[model samples]
Target: MDLVNSFLNFVVPPASLLMLAFSWPTLSFINVCEWIYDTYFREIDMDNKVAVITGASSGIGEQIAYEYAKRGANLVLVARRDTRLRGIAENARRLGSRNVLIMAADVVKEDDCRRFITEAINFYGRVDHLVNTASLGHTFFFEEATDPSVFPILLDINFWGNIYPTYVALPYLRQTKGRIVVNASVENWLPLPRMSLYAAAKAALINFYETLRFEVKDNVGITIATHGWIGTEMARGRFMVEEGAEMQWKEEREVHVTGGPVEEFAKLIVDGACRGNAYVKYPSWYDVFFVFRVFAPNILYWTLQMLSTNHVVRRTSYIGTGRPLYLEGSPPRKFLTAGPSTQVPVQQQLKME
Candidate 1:
């Protein structure tokens, strides 16, 4: 009894509050890591506005930029990949954006965020939408995982990467009454096998976003795009590189409902912004489950656990069978062509035979 009480005392909110009081201002700044947290912190609408997207090279970030551009919004695209950023900027311009600026920088650094915000103000003359879409994912069994070093990198991109840009952009977002859209994963809501750390980080994002929604309800709109299954490039690469090297092409792609293509997913987000909704989910069935979680979390949790193990390869790749998986551009088929010398190309083999 004493031990349990002591443990609770150490971990309880009061203890945490005490620790925070003595700490620097850094802890509080974490709330802005992802869009969900910034919802409460900003005041803005998204239409015909300046939208800032982190990780704007590909996947959800690129999609968001395209969405805004089509709506005739100006853009500031931020990412580490200069080539991809330039491509997206050009596309944004073609898609009817008045102006597009690309910034190549890692969002985890405070200075980078400051630079991004400064550039946004200069390019668009104002700020509106701040979308936190940069994230990283890894595959390894918890028991087999052996990288204490990788955690910081993951948190930097996943947590701090989400926060820093939003922090620097908040004052601008507040002034413009712009919306903050966070691209948090559904794994944050439904924790699954082998992705414990990623899921936990997402859950923190969701919690922060939800609370922020309450705080900012009377102010600007805050939209949290808590997503599952949209077939982004990162998810596709992870699928193709399952277990590092093996490309198990025979499997059924480890998806429940088919994840939409990039353009389709982006449209849904545009619609969500139009509706002024707070929390949105993709592949709508999963959204239903997120709602069900409110009433019976245990039931919801087990149902997902059961659904995870039902896989095409019976869990052969990485993480177990029932774990959440994303599909790629489909399987690769081999062509055989044989030669007389038996040094036949697969295509040549087929032709000769």
Candidate 2:
């Protein structure tokens, strides 16, 4: 496509080719939307449909909850903080959602998972959708990181986190032929050097959801979003950045990765979920890279290492802070309090809740 786009760019203007490419995708999407409304939504109803979402307290999860609620989805928002969960539930109710049940259970617990899903079934009597967007993403060089021992902990949240929910919800999903949207990260493809843990966990999620779609093909539909970075709390919280690591958010002289706005990204996610898509990728550029990383590993990784901030950069101080490249202050979320939940630390809150 790049080569074709280049040839067209030389003949006409690059802008013209971009416009042509953009026009076709929009029309194709409309066709899919029509098919979905006819096959599922019109046949059923979403006015008070039920959706169970993990990691609903902040970042992408919160936005997804907002997007679904806007469409009248009765949400079961799961996260660990009682305060944050309650705040999100209230805001969702105000957003025109008919019912919003707040479940302050940390999905990391198996018992919590079974109970949460059971209650969701009893409360709304059906689950129309399930979105798994939770993960613990502290990464470092496998050897240098003391957190190497933390892999099981991360997996418990990232992998088992979605597993138990799917298990309990599956019987219901099979009944309703509900949709499942699992949030996998872009690193599932472009594995960054020091971001080993995050990449591995996300990769596992990708494989699980991909296979899951086929497993439940006759019943529920599945969509795996290999998301790129977005402007969310995960992006804002800088503590996770390792000292001297070359992150995408670093200065021009430093290494860094580019990202998209959170709401915009979340909107695309909702659109795909509504349509029951199989895969959803963003910034749209990474689609080709995902393929390249598979077929041309050597050249792709070598060249990307230069353009991307995947560690191995010249040594520097570990001082972490990024001057707001965009604007300061959180954007207004109508009736929404957007940030990490502070009612309790994730570990303690999950257990308490």
The prediction achieving the highest TM-score against the true structure is: 2
For model 2, how does the per-residue alpha-carbon lDDT over 149-173 read when each residue is reduced to its tens digit? 3457656777888888888789998
| lDDT of residue 121 for candidate 1 | 92
Q: What is the lDDT, from 0 to 100, of the residue 53 in candidate 1?
A: 84
- Specify the highest-lDDT model's number: 2
The residue pairs in collision within model 2 are 247-256, 248-256, 248-257
lDDT of each: 0.65, 0.67
CA deviation > 4 Å runs, candidate 2:
1-45, 238-258, 308-353
Determine which window of 10 residues in candidate 2 has minimal summed lDDT: 344-353
Judged by lDDT against the true structure, how good is candidate 2? 0.67
User: What is the RMSD, in Å, between candidate 1 and the native fold over all Cα?
Assistant: 12.2
